[model samples]
Target: MSDNKLWEGSTPFKEKSHLFKYRNWLADNRNIYFNSYEEIWQWSVDNIGDFWESLWDYFNIIAHSPYKSVLETTTMPDFKWFDGARLNYSEHIFRHAQLEQSAIIFGNEQGDYSELSWKDLKKKVASMATYLKSIGVTKGDCVVAFLPNVPEATISFLAVNAIGAIWSSTSPDFGTESVIDRFAQIKPKVFITVDGYFYNGKPHDKTTVANNIASALPTLEKVIVLPYLKKEDVSGFPKDFIDIHTIFKTDGGELVFEPVDFNHPIWVLYSSGTTGLPKAIVHSHGGILLEHLKYMAFHNDVHKGEHYFWYTTTGWMMWNFLQSALLMGATIVLYDGSPTYPDFYKLWAFSENVKINHFGTSAPFLVASMKNKIAPKNNCNLSSIRSISSTGAPLPYEAFEYVYKNIKSDVWLCSMAGGTDVCTAFVGGTPFYAVYPSEIQCRALGVSLYAYNDDGQPVVDDLGEMVIDKPMPSMPIYFWNDPNKERYKASYFEHFPGKWRHGDFIKINSKTNGLVIYGRSDATLNRHGIRIGTSEIYRSINKIDTIEDSLIVNLELEGGNHYMPLFVKMKPTYKLTDTVKNQINGLLKKEYSPRHVPDEIIEVTDIPYTISGKKMEAPVKKILLKMPIEKSINIDSMKNPESIDFFLQFAKQI
Candidate 1:
C-alpha cells in the first residue's frame, strides 16, 4: 500500500516530539547514535534494560528503593520488571501537582462543568485516605467501586492507591449479577457506589442493583454511597450503607504514600466475560507507572499543562489510562453521561469548551457521527485539538477520511489498537511519524510486537495473530483467585507457548511498517474456504448511506453446508429493501471478493455491543448456534441487552 500521509508533524511539533528529545538525550548522555525512528525502536527492544533505565531517569521516577536490575527475567508471563523497586503510583501523580493547576476538569451530558485544583484534589484524597484508615482499611485490601465518572471516583481511586490498597471499579449501569460476578471474585472490603446516575437525559436509579450487590458480597465491611442523581432517599439504602459526605467531613491530614513492591497489585481489571465470569486481571504499581509514563509522553505526546480527555466510563481501561495523565501534569477531562445525548455534537462542543489538547474516543463514535452528518468543523471551534485518538475497534478507512473531512484537517488522527489485557496500546501513534489513514503509526516503544501466522512464526504483509515476542512492563501480574497461574497461562500463553498471543487479527504494511487491525481473530468470517475479517465487510457496509450499524455472523452446520447472515440497523428514513441488499452485496463483491457476499440480509432494531463499545460477534455466533442465552453472554455487560431478543426470535425461526 502507498503511504497515505493524512497529517505530518509541524515544525513546532517536531521540536517538541518526545522521540526527538529522547534521541538527543541518548546522544548526549549515553553516546548512542540513531538516525531514524525504526533504529530507535529496534535499539529500545534490543537493549531492553538500558531502554527502561533511560525511561526511569527521563521521567525521574520517584522510587523509595532503587531497583537492583531493570528486568529480572525476560519470560512472557513471569517477566519481572524493576524488581526491588519500592514506589507508590499515587506519589508519582502528586509529584506533578501544582497548587494553581487543575488536576481534573469534569462534565456530563447535561452541560454541568466543574474543576478541582491540585490543592483541593490533594485535600479530598487525604481526607478519604484518613477515613479509610479509621475504618480499619490497610495495605493490600481491595477497594471496589460502582461509581460514575465523577470527581469522587477520582478521589476514591487516588485514596485507595495512596494507602497501598488495590482499586477496582465498574460503571453504575452494570447489573447486580454482573457486578457480583466480578467483585465477589476479589471480595473487596470497601464497596463505593452511587445511588443513581443519568443517561440519555433520563435518571436511572441503581439503588436496587447496589443493594443486591452489597447483600451478595459478605466481605464488604462498609458500603459508601454518593448522591449522584439526588432522586433517591438514602434512608431506603441498607443499614450498612454510609453517606460519602460523612467521610469527607473528617478532618484532613497529610496524605501518606505507601511504598509497595514492584509487583504488588494496584488494580483489578476484568475481561468481557462473554463466555463465563470475567477474569479479574491484576496490574502492578511499578509496571503501570512506567508504562503510562512511556505511553502518554512518547506515544501520545501528552505534555504538562495540556488538557487530555477520553470519552470513557470508570469500567473501561481508558478511564484508568486517562487518570495516568495526572502523572504527566496534564489535566484530565471526565464525562459521565451519554456521549450522544441531547445531540450528536455534544462531545465536539465539550472539546471546544474545555480546550482539549488531546481527545480520545472509540471508532464507533466517529462512524456514528459521520453517518449522522454531524460536522464539528462547521459548528465548533476545535483549534485546541492537536491529536484525536481512536481505539476500542479497528478504525475503518472511511472513518479516518471522515475525521479529516468533517472534523479537523490539521490534527493527528491516531488509530490505535490494544485492549484491557495490557491496559495500554501496543500499536499507536508517535509524534515523529506521519498519520496514515486507518493504520496505527508504529509499534509502541518497549513492546516487542509482531504479527505471527498460525504456526507461531512471524509474518509481514499478511493477516495473522498479533503477538508480543518479548515481555513488557505492563502485562498483567496475575488473575485474581487464579492460583497456580492456570487461568493466567491459559488466557494468553496457551495459544502459543512462551509468547503473548493477543487474539487480534492484524497485518503490518510492508512498505510503511504501519499496523492495520482486522477484527478479532476468533470472529473472522470464512467463506468458500477463504478467511476474511469481519471488519472488511463492515468497512464496505459503512460506506452505504442508509445503514447506521451492522453485525455479521457465519455458521457451519453439521451437514456440508454453511450459512452467513447480515443483520443491519438502518437509518430512520431508509428501509431494508431488495435494492439496498443488492447494493450491499455489490459493494462487497466489487471491493472485496465474490465470496464476501452474505447469504441472507435482515434488518434489526439495534446491534449488540459490549459496554466498552466492542461488537459481540463471538457471543452472537454462539446464540445463532442455539446456545443458551445465559451461557452465551453476560447481558449486563452489553450496551443494549434488549437487542439480543431479535436474534433469539430469529434463531427459533431458523
Candidate 2:
C-alpha cells in the first residue's frame, strides 16, 4: 500500500503463480468473482465450506471413502472436518512417487551427503512398515522416534503413518528427561532412535539417553537403533536394542496404506514445555493432509520437481511441515548438524549447490547473518531461489532489509508467524502480494484471524491478542490424555469463550492489510503504565554491532516498584562498559520511547532458546519473579541450558 515494494515480479512469474491460477479456477468453476487477492481471501473465510471443498478437489486428495460433508460443526474445539471420510496420511504422500524423481536430499556438518530416489524411498518405507507391524504396532498405537533430520527419520515416519499408527519425534539433542516427559505421556509402543548424532563438529552419543527413555516408558515393546555416528561402536546400547539395518535387510513388499477415520490421530506434537510438562497436541490425517496440500500447493507455490528446503531438526514442527513438501511432489532437502557449523553461510551454500527453489529458516539465523555481515551473493550463486521464508520468531525490520539488500535483490522474503499449536502458519506470504519489510504479507487464506483488544472486540491498526474467530482444519483435534477436554479448553478457549486465542501480540495495518507480530502476549513487558513487546526492544538493540542477541524481562518488586533489566549476549571482542550500556539505552530511547529503556543493562554469556529456536521469555520472566528454575522451565529442551545460570544469579541478588 506504501508503494515501497522490495521486489517486483516478472510477467512469467505472475502468470504462473498459484494464486493467479486459483483465482481463475474460482471464476471458471464456481462462477465466483475475485478482482484481487483480498477479495479471494474474503470469500475463502466467508464461505469456508466451499473453499475447503474446492481445495480437496483442486489438490486431488486421495481418499478411500468420500466425505458426507465438509464440516459438521463450526464451533472451536468441537469443529469436525471431512466427516465420514477414511484416508491414510502416507497414502497421499506416496501418490506422486516417481521412479526417477529425487525424494530427499540429505546433508550434514560432516560433509556427508546422500540422495534418495522415490523408488528407494518407497522400498525403505515398505520394509520399515512391515518391521513395525511385526513388532505389534497397529492402528492407534504410538511410535516415538529420537533421531536427527536424516532419511531414516523420514522413512520411519512414513512407515508408521502407513500402518495407521501415530508418529512423533524429537531431535537427539534433547536430554533424556525432556524426551521421557513427552513420549511417556503418549505411551509409545515402539521406540526408534539413532546411537549418536553430530552437532557443531562433535559427536554426541545418545545411547545412554535412549536407554533412559526406554526404561522409563513401560509400554515400549522394542527399541530400534541406527548407527549414525561411529557406526562400529554400539557397545553401550541396551541388550534389547535391534539394529535398524536388520529391519531393512529383507525384500521390500508393496506399500500398504491402512485407511482410518478422518479424525484419526496422525502425529502428536508438543508444546514448548517451558512452564511445565509439555502438552501432547494431536493432529489428524485428513486435517493435516488438506491443510498441507493447500499450504504448499497454493500459499507456498511449491511445484513438482522443485527442491524445497527448510533448515530444521526432527524435534521441531517445521520438519513435519517440510516433509509435506514431498506430498506436493517437491524434493525435500534435509540438513542435519549445525546451520552455522563450518561457517555462518553453510545453508546458503547448500541452497546454491542444490538449486533450492524455496529456502526456509528461522529469523534468528537471518539476524545473526546480518550482524556478521555475511553476504550470500558475494560467494554463492542463488539464482535458483525464488523465495526465502523466515519464521520461528518475528523477523526484525533490519533483517528483512538485509535479505533484500545483502542476500538477494530479486527474491521474495516471506516472513510468517504461527506456532506448533496448528503445525502450520496462520499468517504468511502469497505469490500475489507485494513483499513489505517486517510485515507478514497477509492472513493465510481460509484462516479467519483478527486482532482482539482486552475487551474481546476486534481492533484495527492496533496491537492486541491474535485470535481465530473461525475453526481451521489443522487445529489440534484434541490434547492427548485430556479426557474431559479441560486442558484443551484452558489452553485456547479460556481467554475468549469460543474463539481460539493464539496468545501472540500482533497488529494489522489498516491500509496495507499486512500483519506485524510483537512478542508473545504473555511475555510482553509492562513498565510503569506502558506495555512494550520485547521484540521492539530487541529490534533496537540488535542494531549495535557488538550485541549478538538479547532478552528483556520486567519484574515487580515487593515495595510496588518495578525492575526492568535487559540481558544481552555481546560478541567475544566486546565488553560491557559504561559507553556500551549508554549506546544500547540511547538506541532504545531514540528508536522507541524513553519508557522503553531498561533499568539495568547486564552482559550474559548466551541467550536461552527452545530447541525450536524461540526465545525463552516467559520462563525467564518466571525465574526473575522468584519461581524455581526447574519448575519454571525444562532445561533439557533448551538449545543452551546453561545460559539460565546467569539469570538465576542475577535473580538471587535482587
Candidate 3:
C-alpha cells in the first residue's frame, strides 16, 4: 500500500479528460455528485441498473425502439439487458463520417501507407453491405472473414454488422485447421478472406489456404476474396469466387442500418481453444455498443478525431474492440503486418507518423523492447503519444520502469487485463487515477470485480480467483452450438454457481484500489499447500538476461508428492547451466518465499503460446501431468505447434 507512485494524475489532465466532462454533466443534469472515482465505482456497481441507464442517457444512445426496462434481472447466465429495444452497432460508427480527419490511417511492415476518408469508408461499407444483401445474406446469418488487420477487414465487419448479420474473423496467420475449427461451428453464410498477406517483409500467399478453408465449411454459401498478393492472377481461384473489388462496381449509394433486438448477436468471438475447439462467444449489438461507449469515454479517455491504434490481428478480440473507437468519432489506425518486422520500433514510428493519442500493444512487445534496449523516445518523435496501454499479460514492475526510464518520461502507462469472454477490460485506466508499477489503475466502473477465496467468498488485498458478482452488459449472450446453455453455464457460471469466474488469479490492493493480476489460476503453482502465481516466477526470471522465455507448472504426483518444474527457453547462444539455475532459484527465494522457487529447472527450445499471444500454461501443465496429448492440447490453437514436440517427449518421462 506504499505510495511509490509512477505518475500522478494532474489537475490539468483531469480538467481536459472525458471522464471529468461526464462527471460534470451528471452533476449538472441529474444532481448526482461524487468526490472520487472509488465513490462513483461503488455507486455504479451497487445500483447496476441505474448506472447502465445513466450511460444510455449520457451517451445519447440511438435506439430504434424504446426499451421497456433498463435491466431485467435474472440468474447469472440468463440476465437480460435493455430488452424491447433495437439498435445497430454499425450505425453509431458512421455518425462521425463528416469529420475532416481520415477515418482510418493504415500501414504495414512493408512501409506502405494508406488512408481512407470517412466518405470512402462509408461508400465501401455500403457497397459491401449491398453486395451481401444481393447474395441473400440477411439478419441473423453468420459472415466470417479470413484476413489481417487491414481497412478492408474493418469495412467487411461493418458491412456485415450493418445488415444485422453476425460477424467473426480470423487472421490469415492462423492455420487452416484453426480457422475452420472456429468458422465452421458458426455455419457462416459468407466467407470473406484475403488471397495473401505480408508479414516480416515476406508475402504469404493464402489463396489456396483460403480455398481449402472455404471447402471445409459446408455451410458457406459464398466466398469473397481480395487478391492482395496477386491481383492479376485469376487461375488459382474458383470461377464462382467473387472478387472483393466487384462489390463497389455499381456504387451502392446510401448505407442502411438494420434494426435488431438489443440482445441480438452482433459477432461471435472465439475463446483460445488450447484444450478443445474454441467456444464461439456471441455478444449482442446493444451490449457491445453500450460497453464500448462507457469504456472508451470513461476508462480510456480517448477524444474525438484523435488517432487510436492497437497492435492486433483479425483473430484477436482487440481487433473487434478497436473498431469501437469509431463509435466515439475517433479515427482508428490499422496496421496489417508485424509489429517487429523491420525493427522493434516499427509501431512507435507508425504512432509518430499517425500522431496516435492512445497507443496500445501487448506487454510482451514492451518487455521485448526493454530487453533489447530500444529507446523509442531516442529513435522517434513520440510527442504525439499520450497514453501507452499494455494488455495480453501483466506488465511487470521492471517493464514499467523501463517505459519511464527509456521510452518516455511523462507518458501515461496503463496495464489492463480482460479476456475474449467480455471483449473488454474489467480493470483499465482512468484519467482520475494515478499510475502505478505492476498494477492496473482501477476496476472499470459498473464492474463488480473481486478476488474470491477458495470458499467462494470475496477477499480484499489477497491472491484469489477473479470473479464478477454482478452482470456486465457485454458478457456473452451464449456460446454458439451450446444447446440448452449447458456449455455456457459450465464455462463460467458453474464454477461459482451464480458469479462469473474469470479463471485468472488477482489481488485487489484495498488501500490503493489497484489490481495486481497473477497468471492463470489453472496454471498456478502449489507447493506445501501454498499457491503461487507463474507471473511472480517470471518476474524473477525476466531479471536474468540468460532466459528468453519460461513456463512454470506444478504437478500433483500419484503419492501425494508435488513436482514443480521451471521450463526456460534460453536466449541465443546461451545454455541453461547450474549457475544460472541457482541464480533463478536464489533470486526467487530472496524476492518472494521458498515456495516461489521451482523444484527443477529445465531447458526447452520454445514455450507454446496461443495465436492470441497467451502462454499455453494450462495445456502444457496438462501434458506434463500425464494427460493424453490429443486431449491435453489442441495443436491448431498453438502459435508454434511444433514447439510442443519437446514438451510432449518431456511429458513421457514425468
Candidate 4:
C-alpha cells in the first residue's frame, strides 16, 4: 500500500474524541490500557463478552431489569446475549430529547424544509403510540410503513417501538409487489404511508400503490396516511383509513417506552429479495441499542449537537443507522429526493445550507461525482464538514484519492462495509487510526472479524472468506418465519459451520492492520482454476472514462468450460469501439494478470442494482446460467427491473 496519509488525528482531535474518552474509561474502571488501536481491538475480540458487557455501563444503557450473564451461549443458531435483561430501544433514543438541537431536520426535492424539535418529536411519538394502542396494537405486534425518508417515518418507528410493536418499512419508490413481498410476510397490524413523494423534480403518486398494498395484506387493521404530496388527498384509499393529521389533532397522550427482553425483536430488515422473498432479519432492541451506541459514539466519533446526515431512503439499512445518531444527541438530517435531482451537486449544496458536520453517502456517489468532475469545494462552503462516510460498496483507491484532492485536504474519510444481515458494520473507521487510501481503517472493536481461506484457516495479507467465530449482540435474533432458523443457518452458518461466513471476500493487511475488500465471494470470477474478485477487474475498468458502470460474471458451462463476460454501460456520448475494448483489456492485463481480462466485452444500457444500491452480479449470473426467470430474481427488488430483460434474452442464446 502507498504511504499516503490523507488525514491524521491530531493531539487535540484525538483527546476530544469519544473513543479517547472510552479508552480512558477502560483504564480507570476496568484497569485496561492500550497504546494502540490494534491492542485495544485484540483485547476486545479476545474477551468479547467482557468488552460488550462493559458497554452496558459505558453507554449507561437504561434497563428495567438486570442481565445475569454477559452471554448465555457461544455457538451458532443458539447463541444468547445478556440473558434476562429487559430494555427498550426507543427509551434510549428519548434520553437525548432534552437536548436543545432539533431531533430531526428534513428537506425534500421540492425545496421544502422542516424541523422537528426534541419536545415536538416526543409529543408526536406519544400521540402515534396512543393511536397504535387504540387500534388494539400491542407488544410484539408488527407495524409497517410505506413512507419516504421523512420525519413522519421516524415518528412512526419511534411510536411503534414506544409501545413494544415491531417496525418495518420500505421507501414509497418501491413497487407494489416489492412492498407486498416484505410487509405481507410480517402481517402488519398497522400500515403507515404517504400519499406520494417528489423525486428528480417530478411527483410520484403512490396513493394507488398504497391502497393496493393495504388490500393485499388481509392482516392490516388500520391504514394511516400522511398527506405529504401537495397534489393528492387520501380519497382513493380503502375504508378504515385514518389520516396521520388526526392522530396529532388530539395530542394529549404521554410518551411511554415499553421494556422488552434483551433479545426481543425491535425491527425487521429484509434481504435484497433478489432470488426469493426477502429474508426478514430480526434485531433485538437491546442488541441494536448496544451496537448503535458503540458504532456511532466510538467508531464515528460523533459529538452532540452536531448535524449528521446520510442520503438514504427508508428501505436501506443506512436509514435505520442514520437515526442512531440521535441516540448520541446529534441532530439527524433527512433528505427525501434523488441525490442528483437537478444536478449532481445537489447534496453538496444542501450540506452547505444545513451546515452538515458528518456527511454520509455511498461510494458510487463519490465515484460518479469524481467522474462528472463536480467539485464541491469550488462551489460550496464545506469547511463545516469534518468527516465524509462512504459505504454500500468498496471505495476504490482512485475514489479515495479524489476525495482528498477535490473535496477537502484534511477531512476524515471513512470507507465501511456491512450488510443487512447485521445492521451495524463489522469493519469501519476509528479515531485512533490514520486515514489510509482504499482501506477500511480497522475492524470494529468486538467484531472478531477474520479472513479465512478455503480450509477455514485465518490468513493475513491474503484473501479469504470473512468469518466471525464469536457472536455480536447485533447479530439477528432470528429471521421471521424461518422455522428453526433453517434459512438463517443455511445463509450464514452452512459454509463455516459455527462461524458466520459473510459473503464478502476481504483481506487484512499484515503491516497496517487495514482491511481491503475485493468483492462478494459468491460472485467471484473464477478464471479457469485461478480465482479473483470482480472488483480487481472493475478497478481497471473505472479508470477508463468511456465506461460508466460494469458487471462481470463467470458462467460454468458444460465440460468444465468457464465463460466470463464483462458487461459495461457506456457513457451517453461514447460507444464501445475496438480501441475502447482494447484499452479495457490492456489495463486489466497490465494491472492484474491476463486472467483478469474477460473472455468477451459487451455493452448494455444499464447494470442492474438492488433497490438499496448494490450491484446485482449474483442474480444476473443465475439468469445467464439458464435458471428460470422467475426463480432467478425478484424484479420488484431491482433498481432497474427492465435492465434484467437484456440478460433473459441472452440466456436463450447460451
Candidate 5:
C-alpha cells in the first residue's frame, strides 16, 4: 500500500501514531493478529468473541456486568454481541462534565457566539431532567422533540437519555402531519420543542405544529416549549403545553441517572418513507455510543477539548452523532440556520473563530456552494480544520478536488455514507488508509461489508447490493411499534434474510479498493435488462461545469416507457442557458449509454431534499407518476418543494 496518493498531493501529516490513545488502539493493534484487510476480516469471523472483546478493551467502553463473552455467534442473523453488559450511556458522556471545560460552543449565521461550560451544560441538563421527572417522565418512556441544531436541542436529548428515557427528534421544519406519523406511533409521553427557529433570515413557526401534534397524539401528556426566535407570550399554547422556563423552577433536586442494558433503546429514528409511511428505526444506546466513539476517536482523530461541529439539524442522524462528542470530552459547536446564509464564508468564519478540529456536512450543500461560487479562500482562516467529512449523497469526485484546491491543501476529505437505519455508517473514514475522491476509505473494520450479486454471493469491483454478512453492535434492537420484529426484519432482512442488505448500489473500486456508493439500489435504473445506479448519471452530470446541481430519477411514462428524467437547479446567478443544456446532453450521450441521456433537462429554482440533505429523487419520481402525495409525506423538511412542480411538468412533456 502506498501513502503518496492517500492524501492526493497534500502535505505530509502523521497518518499513524504509536501513542496508546483509546481511539487509536484499533489501528495500533490491527497488525498484531492480521496482516491485511482480508486477514483482519477473517479473524473477526473466526474469533468473533476475541474480536469484540478486544474492541471493548481497545475503545475503553465502560460497562457493568462485564461481558464474560464478546459474542455468541451461532449464525450471522441471530448473532448476539456483548451479552450481559450493563452501563449507563449517559454516564460515559457525563464523565466530561468537569466544571472548567467548555462543553458547547455555539454560533449562528448572523455572527454570534454562545459558550456553555461543562458545569453549565450539566447544570442545564440536570435542570431539564428534573423538569422531565416532575412531568412524570420515567424510564422506558418516549420524549419527542423538534428543534434546531442548537445547544438546547443537544442538552435536551442528553437529559432525556440521561434518565433512561428514549429521545426522538425532528427538525422544526417538519409539519404537524409528519411529526404525528412518527411520534404518534411511539406514543411519546413528553414533547420537547422550541417556539420557533431561524433559517435563511426568516423566522419559522412551530407553535401551531407542536400544538397540533400534542393534541393529536393521545399518548402525549405535555409539551415543553423553549422559546428561540419569538419570545412573545405563548398564550396560544395548548392547555397541555408548558413553558421551559417554568421547568427551570428551583423545585429540583440533584440529577438522578439511570443505568440500562447494552441493548437498551436510546432513540427511535425514521426513514424518509417517501415510498410509503416512514419506518421508525429504533437504535440502542450501547451500539450508537460505542460506534460513534470508535469513528470519532480513530477515524476523525478527535481529541478531548477539541472543537467539533457538524452542519445538521436535529432531524438528521449526524446531529445525534455530534452529541457523542460530550462523551469524548470535546466541545461541540452548534450552529443553527443556513450553513451559507448571510454570507458564503459563514461556516468558514465560524471555524476560524472556534478553531474547529473535525467538521462534517452533506455533499449537496458542498455542490451548491461550489455552484454558488462561495470560496472560503479570501475571508476565512480554515487552518484549524483537520477532517472534513461529507455524507447524505454520493459526493462527486470533482467535489473532492474542489475542496482540496479551494478549501485547504492539507485536509482529510472523508466521503461517508450511511443512513438512519443503523444510526451510523457502514462505509466511512479510517486513518490507516489514504483517501480517493468521492470514495469511502473502506467498509467499517468489523462490518463484514460486501457487494452481493443477484445470487446473494459476494463480489468485488462490481456494482451490487451493499450487504453485511455479520451483525454488529449498532444493529437496531427493533422498531418502535413493531413487537414481533416483523417490520424491523422486513426492512433489511427480508431481502437477504439473516444478512443486512443496505439498499445502496455500490462498487468497490478495483484500483483504489475504496467504495463508491453509486446510489440507492431501489433507485437503480434498469434499461434493456441492465441496472445502472443513479449516481452514475449524477457523477457525470455534476462534472459539467455549467450545471450547478441536479436530481436524476427513473420516470415511467404512460406507455410503460421508462427513461431517466433529470431536473437541475442552476446557480443563483447562472441560468440553464441553451449552450449549457446542450453541453450537458452531449456529455451524457458521449460518456454514458445513449439511454442515460435524460429525455428532458428541465430547469428549476431548486431541487427538493430531505432534512438529511439527500436529493428527494424518490418523491419527485412519485409526483411524476401523478400519484397524490399524502400529507404524511414530510416534504416540509425539504430544502425546496416548489421544484417538484417543475419535475412534474417535465414528465408531462416527455
Candidate 6:
C-alpha cells in the first residue's frame, strides 16, 4: 500500500500546531533520537533498545535509576523493558496535582453533573491515602474496589497506588459469586465499595454482595463504603466497618507517594476463560504507563487538557486505557448507566452537555441505535467530538455509515480490536488516516502485527489468524495462579508455535491498507472445508432496520455437518414479520453469498453478553447443544442469561 492511501486526509494532522509541537521538540532535542512518528515506529522495531529508552526519556518518565539496558536478549516472552528502572505508577499520574486544571467530569443518566478539579482530586486522593495508611495498608498489599465510574472509585484507585498498594476493581453490579471468585484469590487487605448504584433509573444495592464476598474471604480487614444511596447495613463487617466520608476529614493531606520498581504489579486484570476459570493477568507499572502514553499521544491523538470519555467499566480494558488520559493531564468524563437509558439519545445528550472531544463506545450500541431508527443529530449537538472509537466488536459497514450520516461526518471512526490478555490494542485508529467503512485504520504503532495462515506462514490477501511477531512492552508479566506457565502457553501459543496467536481472524486489504476482523478465530465456522467469519453475515443482516441485534453460530446437525443458524432480536417497536425476514435474507444474499444467509432464523428477546460487553457466542452454542456452560467470568452487566434458553429451544426444534 502506498503512503498516500494510508494518509488520504486533505488536512495534515501532523502539521497541526499541537501535533507539530511534539515533532519540533523531537527534532530540537538531539538527546531523543526519533524525529517523526514514522521514524520512531521504525526505530522502535529496529533498535528496540534506544527506541524505548528514548520513549521513556521523551515522555519524561519519572524513574529512580535509568535502566542499564532497554531490553534483554532472550525469548520473546521473557524479554524485559527498562531492566533497572524504578518508578511508581501513581506518582506519574499525580505529576500535575498542584495545577488548577480539571481532573474528572462525572455525570449519570439523570443529568446530574459533578466536576473534580486537579487540585481537588489530588487532595481527595491524599486524604484517602492517609486514611488507608493509618489503617495499615502498606507496600505490596492488595486493595480491591467495588464501585462505579464515580469520583470515589478513581480517588480510591489513586489512593491505593499512591501508598504502593496494588489496585483491582469491578463494577458494583458484579454478582456475589463473581465478586468472591476473583477477589478471594487475591486476599485483599481492604475493600472499597458503594452502598448502591443507579442504572437505567433503577437502584441495585451492592452492600449485600460486598458483605457476602467479605464473609467468604477471611483476609479482608476493612470495608469502606460510600453512600451513593442511603447507608445500608454492613452485613459481615466487624465493628470497624466505617463510612468513607467519616474516615477522610480534610480534603488536603500530605501526599506520601511510594517509589517502586518498573516491573512491580500495578493492576491485576482478569481474562474470561471459556473452559472453566478466568485467568488473572498481571500488568506492571512501567509497561502500562509507557504503552498507554504511546497509544494516547500518537494513535488516539489525545490533546492535553481535553475531556476524554469511554463508556466502560472496571471489568473492561477500555476503563484502564481511559484512566491513562489522566496521566496526560486530561479531564476524564465518566458515566455509569446504560447509554440508551430513558431514550436512545442519552449518550449524545451527555456528550453535548459535557462537550467531549474524544468519545469511545462499542459497535453493538451504535448498531442498535441504527436499527431503532434513532438519530442523535435531532436530539444533541455532537460538534465537539473529533474522534469516535468503536471496539468490543467489529464495526459493521452500516454502523459506520450511520455514524457518518447521523453523528458527525468529520469525525474519525476508529474500529479497534484487542483483548484483556495485553490490555492494549493490536489495531487502532490513527489521526493521520482516513476512516474506512468496515476496517481498522492501521496496525498500532510499535506493535509487530501480521496475519498468518493455518500452516503458520504469513499471508497477505486472504483471511488468516492474526498474530504479533514481536513482544511489545505491554505484554502481561505473569498469570496470577499459573506458576508452571502451562495454562499461559495453552492460552496463546498452543495454536501456533513460538508466535503469539491473538485468536482474531482478520483479512487485510492490501489495496486500501485496511484490516477487517471477523469474530474470534476459535468460533469461526467451517462448513464443507471452507472457513467463514460470523461478522461477515451480521455485517450484512444488520443494515436492515427490521433487525435490532443478531447472533450467528455454526450448527452441527445429526449427520455432523455444520450450518449457520441466526438468532435475531427485533426492534422493540416492530415485530419479525414475513416481509422483514425476507428483506433480511434478500439483503444477505445480495451483499454476501448464499452461504452467508442462515438456514434458520429465530426471533429472540436478548443475546447473552459477557460482563465486558462482548457477545457470549461460545456459551450460547453450548446451551444450544445441551452442554454445560462454565461459570460466567463476570456477570455484572448481564441483562438475562436465561434468554439463551429460548434460542436453544428454537434451535432444537429446527
Residues 38-70 of candidate 1: C-alpha lDDT, one tens digit per residue: 788889888888998999998888889988888
List where candidate 4 sits over 4 angstroms from the true fold: none
State TM-scores per candidate.
0.98, 0.98, 0.99, 0.99, 0.92, 0.93
Query: Model 1: residues >4 Å from true position, as ranges?
Result: 231-233
Q: After best superposition, candidate 1 residue 375: deviation in angstroms? A: 0.8
* lDDT values for all models: 0.90, 0.89, 0.90, 0.90, 0.76, 0.77
Off by over 4 Å in 2: 1-3, 558-560
Q: What is candidate 3's CA lDDT for residue 278?
A: 93
RMSD of 1: 1.4
| Total backbone clashes of candidate 5, pairs 3 or more residues apart or in separate chains | 0
Candidate 1 lDDT score at position 240? 70
Q: Which runs of model 3 end up more than 4 angstroms from their true locations?
A: none
Each prediction's Cα RMSD? 1.4, 1.4, 1.1, 1.1, 3.1, 2.9
Worst 10 residues of 5 by lDDT: 10-19
Q: How many residue pairs clash in all the candidates, one count each? A: 0, 0, 0, 0, 0, 0
Native-referenced Cα lDDT, model 3: 0.90
- Could you give candidate 3's per-residue lDDT for residues 1-654 as a string of tens digits? 337788877899999988898888879988989999998999899999989999999888889999999888846988999999998999999887864569999988877799999988999999999999999999999999998898999999999999999999999999999999999899999999888888888889998899899999999889888877776565677889888888866687799999999999999999988889899999999999999999988988888889999999989999998999998889999998888878998888888888999899999998888877789989889999888889999888889989988888898887888989999999999988888789899999999989999999999988999999899999999999987889988988878999999999999998889998888988888777998988898888999987898988899998899999889999999999999999999999999998888889999999898999999989988998878877899899888999999988998897
lDDT of 5 by residue, 276-387 (tens): 6678888878878777776676556677888888898888888888888776788988898888788777888888988998888888878767766667866788988888
Q: What's the TM for model 3?
A: 0.99
